[model samples]
Target: MYAIPDSRLPLPQVLDRFPAGVPHRRNHVNDYLLVPREVDYFNGFLALLGRAQPPLQTDQLATAARNLNDVAAGDTPSPCIQQRIQHAHLLEQLLQDRDWEPSADISRELKLVVAYLHASRQLIPDTVPGVGHLDLAIVIDTAWPKLAAEVANFVDYQRLRHLEAERQGRSDDAIAFNRSSWLELREIEARLHEHQRRVREGSYAPEPFTYFRVH
Candidate 1:
């Protein structure tokens, strides 16, 4: 796990402790495409998650998952609501650790992302009629892709562990990796491969993959 600081990046002295420089308050929702600075901010956030250091909190992930808690709904395809709900579900699965255990470092990053999700005075507040979740969406968009592989691996590991224990007639203390998680992990793997293929065949240069895992 990366040793990203538990405290946010310090404000520039000139900003007088204003939160525009803060991760939760940066208001990246103003632009449809990420501006260069927004890119820098999110990239730094990712790097912080990937840093090989002690985790800040394993329990913090629940905070984010709670925000994503869903109300009863019919099968609707509202992208914004559905998208956030999905993101929340992912966080919830990891937080509950039904499948595999994450190291302290991975938990720390997850905690940070959750904290941002639940911030009351974020870049855009939920009180702002239609556009409130934009900031949350943007933050998730920036952060979740990097975590795709780790989530996938954890799910797979749990599945393998289940098999190993079953074969050896050992106790399976961990919850069995379910069909939904397996499917989600497969989808993540497919998307990652497609991304790599694009980098290989397109104009972009290939970069090494990085995430909060130690291995």
Candidate 2:
């Protein structure tokens, strides 16, 4: 398993710092559900996904937890919630891309998170009056570090492939190479550009052989 740093897991931070102040106080039921309770429950759902066996009778609490946590957390002050949710769509696209090979753990995590994003009734249902996507935002924020590198690399691969396709007058899908091939192509292009630069510089002769010039 790839070693993810502890900081990438938001649970610890949420546990340590939340329920401590205005926005996340335990008495503030909406805020409480959105911050720690729902997030904690969602983490449990992720655990369930990793298991091979079907959920046990006792595992039914996850369902109950989801239902109990079904809350309409009123408006979030954070403006980034919409943008963050949109970014989740990008992760969804990355998950769907057959050519990209994320690590097994990452792939599984993405599948589960993306499944939650698509679910009709999430911790805060998408149709809720406000803060519908806040839970998703929290989940994605937690998982972002894990997904960030793969998403960036996939995006770069797509860009280079698209440019190559345009040069060849073909569709992006017509390119038959994968990430490794793209890296090789990028390296070759870099080397070729460096060689061209050296050639250009070599064309310019020094002002003169100073020793040979009259003093």
Candidate 3:
């Protein structure tokens, strides 16, 4: 079997969807230009994205995100990784939709993005020894900002729900707890947005990476 299939289209056509939010890192790849295999790999992956399957069901995905949160409790994931997780988590919360309901438009958008996130494989398969998540991360990061208002609205809904619960019991300190969670969510959102701003403005960037032929 072919390790990485050749793209149906010419190279330039394949790159059109990429680097939209993924800045061509100031790394060896861009500096030296990409090798033929690397170029073909991207083309192939971009093509496959059109047919990729969902990576996880909503409940399963929520479990995965919660597990990651538990594992990373008190630690940090680099900004790129963190933003990708947060975006997925926010969508998870929306899909759960237990406490807050989104507008029809927001709900559809969240589901679409979440499905994209769940793709078991991508232009770059996650099974790659390293940097497997790069393609997924870049796609989510590109889509992250557009979802901000909905995410913030969901946080607001959570805050109000907890406050209501507090009034009924008015003793569990649910109010305080929810407030803290909201603060944490907003902080992460702010940081992610700032990071995106810097990337777009060309002010700052996370360390660049070498190419892995996108298989």
Best by TM-score: 2
- Which residue pairs in candidate 3 collide? 45-123, 55-118, 55-119
Writing each residue's lDDT as its tens digit, candidate 2 over 103-203 gives: 67678778877888888646656554344565576567656757777767777778777778898899988877677877987888889999999988786
Model 3: how far is 107 from its true place, Å? 3.2
lDDT of 1 by residue, 50-118 (tens): 533222121121222223333313333224544654565566566666555555556776777777766
lDDT of each: 0.48, 0.58, 0.47
Rank by lDDT (best first): 2, 1, 3
Report how far off residue 134 is in candidate 1 (Å): 1.0
User: Residue-wise lDDT of candidate 3 within 1-215, one digit each (tens)?
Assistant: 10111221111112223323534332221112224454345444433334232322222222223333343434353344455655576677667754345666555556656776676534444443223344455455344445567666666656555655566787433344443455566677689999999778884566577765767
Task: Write down the TM-score of every candidate.
Answer: 0.37, 0.63, 0.42
Clashing pairs in 2: none
Error of 2 at 184 (Å): 2.0
Q: Which ranges of candidate 3 are over 4 A from the true structure?
A: 1-77, 127-130, 170-215
Report the lDDT of model 2 for residue 210: 53
The predicted structure with the larger lDDT, 1 or 2, is 2
Alpha carbon lDDT at 167, candidate 2? 85
